[model samples]
Target: MEGNNDTVVTEFILLGLSHHPRAQAMLFGVFLVVYLVTLLGNGLMVVLIFVSPLLHNPMYFFLSNLSFLDIFYTTSSVPQMLVNCFSHQPTISFEGCIAQMYVGLFLGIAECFLLAVMAYDRLAAVCSPLHYTLIMSKRLCIQLATISWAAALLLTLIAVVLQPTRFCGHNVINHFSCELQAFLKIACSDTSLNDLLIMTNSIFVLIIPFCFILVTYGRISLAVMRIQSAKGRSKAFSTCGSHIVVVTVFYGSAMSMYLHPQGKISSDRGKMISLFYGAVTPMLNPLIYSLRNKDVKGAFWRLLGKKVSE
Candidate 1:
């Protein structure tokens, strides 16, 4: 049965953060600096993790992969957005839009799961120190990372494949990039199934991981409290603090953008929030994790010393 179709959208115009001429230069400079920092920060982490034998543990191994994902995750959308900040017409082809959406969703979801897995790794290391190595072995770390990537890819594939069936009402996308929610709003087809699928996916990919992180942190807190020495408790809390902060920002902003009702909020306002999670969060993660970490700082100094000696 063929449904009534009025029009087909071949491309989408991305109404990025602002259209002001003066704001363009400022936004470009800001994002350019951010992009450079994001690249350098994440790239350095990956290199350090690979080169430094001290960082060969499962935690750093996962962190290396997380850094790599963050790099690509930001690259997938931010560059284009930056380009659009200067371009007269910021349009993405229909196919390009779909691709961007796919990559963004895949990496975003993967990061969520990866963070939870990292939390679990930390929990095992802190709460069960004796069995830490046994539980988070290299093989198990590889398996967990593989599962995170595979699950994200599978979900993204499903969402993209289902998208073609939906009718495109308009070619304009209000956000800076092609997002699932923004695209769904313009879909003329009955989107009940799509909405249901998105909700289910959110529960699995977002909510489940959030629950795991929360539970793990709860256990970690209990374990920290049990420590007799103040120094031990403080050390434990400090080690987990960075991860907790990263998780909070990433998940908090994402949930606010996706799960919250868009009722009275303007589309432009929503776009700014989306930009924070989708672009800004990825850029900030590596900096937050590495800059605040003693291990990472020590690794950086050693790497720099080696460079200086050469």
Candidate 2:
């Protein structure tokens, strides 16, 4: 009994979004299209940001990185999920599951902090126009982006290391991807400690940054109000609106999924919410920014026109 085989589960079976045979067949096509769109949308956004000199600014710098994060964040699970759609028993290796969970969680947390950074960038641009350049230097922007990514890794790594040690029985994950909550449901040990660690860290990655963003926007609102020109006020809101829309979509579904009050958001609920937050939002981000932000639209047309000439 030195190493009991029963004490360890090598893999987990994920029950994807639907259980119906007919639905499963249909869902494969649906998710395939979604996955492709997520790639194309986020991918093109990243490429456009890099190539367009007009877009080479601190704000677009963060947006480009955000698009990159959305690309990888969606990629971390969607491909495997698409494959699972056709499988009889959608299974993932223990290590594969751990890696997937960490990647998704890391990108998600990074986005939270990055969005907050962008919020501050907007605040300085609107509230402190004279010092905007000094406040958001290239070096400072790079450092902020670097810190967001590094902090996410550090925070998610804590859960990644702690969660796997708790896995003992019931390896059936009730979701398409190897999500932390899905793992928690099947973990044989008492998951109160793991959940506590998760909630505690969620404060950093989810709640605190969101609060900071709200506060920044409050000051931004006041600053915009004091501007004499209607056009100037309109322009300020137009610029910040895109970010606000994206933040709403991303955090709305994420908070619904993770920060529920009942403490028992069913796995059935989990699958639907994950499909939205994980797959749908990434596809929407580029469209939101491109359609609303005048600069991105201008850059996109310039880039497209250049490409056509070639």
Q: Please state every model's RMSD to the true fold in angstroms.
A: 2.1, 2.0
**Residue 203, model 2: Cα distance from true site in angstroms:** 1.1
lDDT of 2 by residue, 13-85 (tens): 8888446768888888888888788788888888888998888888889988888999898889988987887
- Return the lDDT, model 1, position 4: 63
List of clashing residue pairs for candidate 2: none
lDDT values, one for every candidate: 0.84, 0.83
Q: Which residue segments of model 1 deviate by more than 4 Å? A: 1-5, 164-169, 261-265
Give the Å error, residue 286, model 1: 1.7
Cα displacement (Å) at residue 282, model 1: 1.5
What 10-residue stretch in candidate 2 is worst by lDDT?
1-10
